[model samples]
Target: MAEEKAAENTAAQAAPQVQMRVLGQFIRDMSFENVMAQKGVSGDVQPEIAVQVNLDAKKRSAEHQYEVAIKLNLKSKAKGLEDILFLCEIDYCGLFHVEGVAEDQLHPFLLIECPRMLFPFLRRIVSDITRDGGYPPVNLDNIDFVALYRNELMRRQAEAQKTEA
Candidate 1:
């Protein structure tokens, strides 16, 4: 019985491991508006920044291939006066060839892991855009993908419940 158990364990251990490769990454769309440059601001300005993030994943026509995209909307304004400072919007996407991930877990894996992989490139773009737009570079903080996924699930559930009621 012990020998049989050992053989079973060995077989399970030999199962294929997950494999993921980034085929490519690119900016699907981007826009930056320097409101401060357009409408000059007078006095001391304290900038307040707001950022919104949205993620999407879709299967490509090719087998084991997926496309993951992230949309970022950023706005900056003077704190007290609420005068617009700048607005930046970007849609970035990555093409991934994935294998060995279980189908049940593929959704979260694509949404979370894929974005985590692409974030650094996206951050660099944001920093450059802000600095070139005449403001100091805005470095974004690290995102918590797990929390983001959970919040999205909860939001969808709440919306569904509201509609059903």
Candidate 2:
């Protein structure tokens, strides 16, 4: 009976209608700037950027939905106070299928899975742009998308509470 139940559970999980997921991806936008940086660094420019990554996710359609786009903007500077070393904007997009998936599962697919897949590519682009712009390669630390999403939720909740108060 236990073996039969396990088989039944596996069959249920294997159903095509029960799984919704992101499939493939393409780049929507990528831009890099460094003219000011070239002159302003005044030295090797060993850049230290105040990196602020803001992530946004949405479903583009109704059917097996899309995880939508991941946008990253980086503004770099040399020393503590200096002109813009460079500003890079990377927009990474992916195909996501969400039909038959719970809203809870879908949420992580967008915030975690989609970005996780795109992050390495985004990081590479950022590094290459910086290197090509005549600076040392920019290496970014790993991002925790789950934590970011949770913080975004808490921030929205706080704003809602503030409005209520």
Candidate 3:
């Protein structure tokens, strides 16, 4: 009886229930304007673009979980003509099971690579959208995920400092 109880207890304890945590993550939001690219140079007309980025974060129900969301807004024009062809927002997150990890490791995992994993898929979708728009493919620039994360940290710190002061 004792051995059976011990075995049961061991099995329960050995079960993988360490809990999930976001060690770190990275996110990227970009836009490509192939129509503008084509008509601007080809038609000898200047193509103007307005690009903006918004970042946000949230916590999941799990004890050690987090999500960093990036939103991108882009608009293109040709010689003051309307070309509002692309409007998109990418909201995706990774399920990270993190335990026994240091903060240094966790931060980068959530801030840098997580977004990198989701970016390719998002990019492919955006490229296809542009291609289908009867223009060349809109390839996104390689993102500086590390820099973006650092900037977010700095901005948050600055806001906190202001609040405290």
Candidate 4:
């Protein structure tokens, strides 16, 4: 029994431990255009907003370092009219030092987990920008990273299938 216990301990020691750290985070690019102000349009504001999110991840030149970015696009318009309200676009990125994640899992970890860490900061920026832009603060809904990842995978698979056919 003692020998078996020792063997188990040795096996555990042989496995690599996972470590992840956020080295830094920042907005790579951002733009806010107040279309209503730009056009000098005046009317009752019943706003309908559309949001799109895209994520990208790439390994940095440094070992165990990766850069992940989230691109957010938002357009707001009056609910019943064709007049525009505002447009906001931002690309937020994080620098991460990651080690010990399996090769197969690294891509998902970078896209999903890194974004989850950086989202609150990005959300705050969006809220501030909207409020300062003369519109009500737009508090973003919480993103579902896992669902996003799965959907992206499904999209890629469908595209590949279309290409092959």
The per-prediction CA RMSD against the true structure, in angstroms, equals: 2.2, 3.0, 9.1, 1.8
TM-score of each model, in listed order: 0.92, 0.80, 0.56, 0.92
Which candidate number would show the highest TM-score if scored against the true structure? 4
| Candidate 3: tens digits of C-alpha lDDT, residues 40-133 | 4454444454655554555568766667665655565655767643444444445565564466666765667666665676567656766676
**What stretches of model 4 exceed 4 Å from their correct place?**
1-11
**All candidates in order of TM-score, best leading:** 4, 1, 2, 3
Residue 84 local lDDT, model 1: 92
Q: In lDDT terms, how accurate is model 3? A: 0.60
Put down candidate 4 lDDT per residue, 70-128, tens digits, no spaces.
99999998998888899999999999999999999999999999999999999999999
62-118 in candidate 2: lDDT tens per residue? 666675677878887766667677888878787776566566677766677678877
Tell me the whole-model lDDT of each prediction, alpha carbons only.
Answer: 0.94, 0.75, 0.60, 0.95
> In candidate 1, which residue ranges exceed 4 Å CA deviation?
1-14, 42-44
**CA lDDT, candidate 2, residue 133:** 76
Clashing pairs in 1: none
Of 3 and 4, which scores higher on lDDT?
4
Q: Which has the greatest lDDT?
A: 4
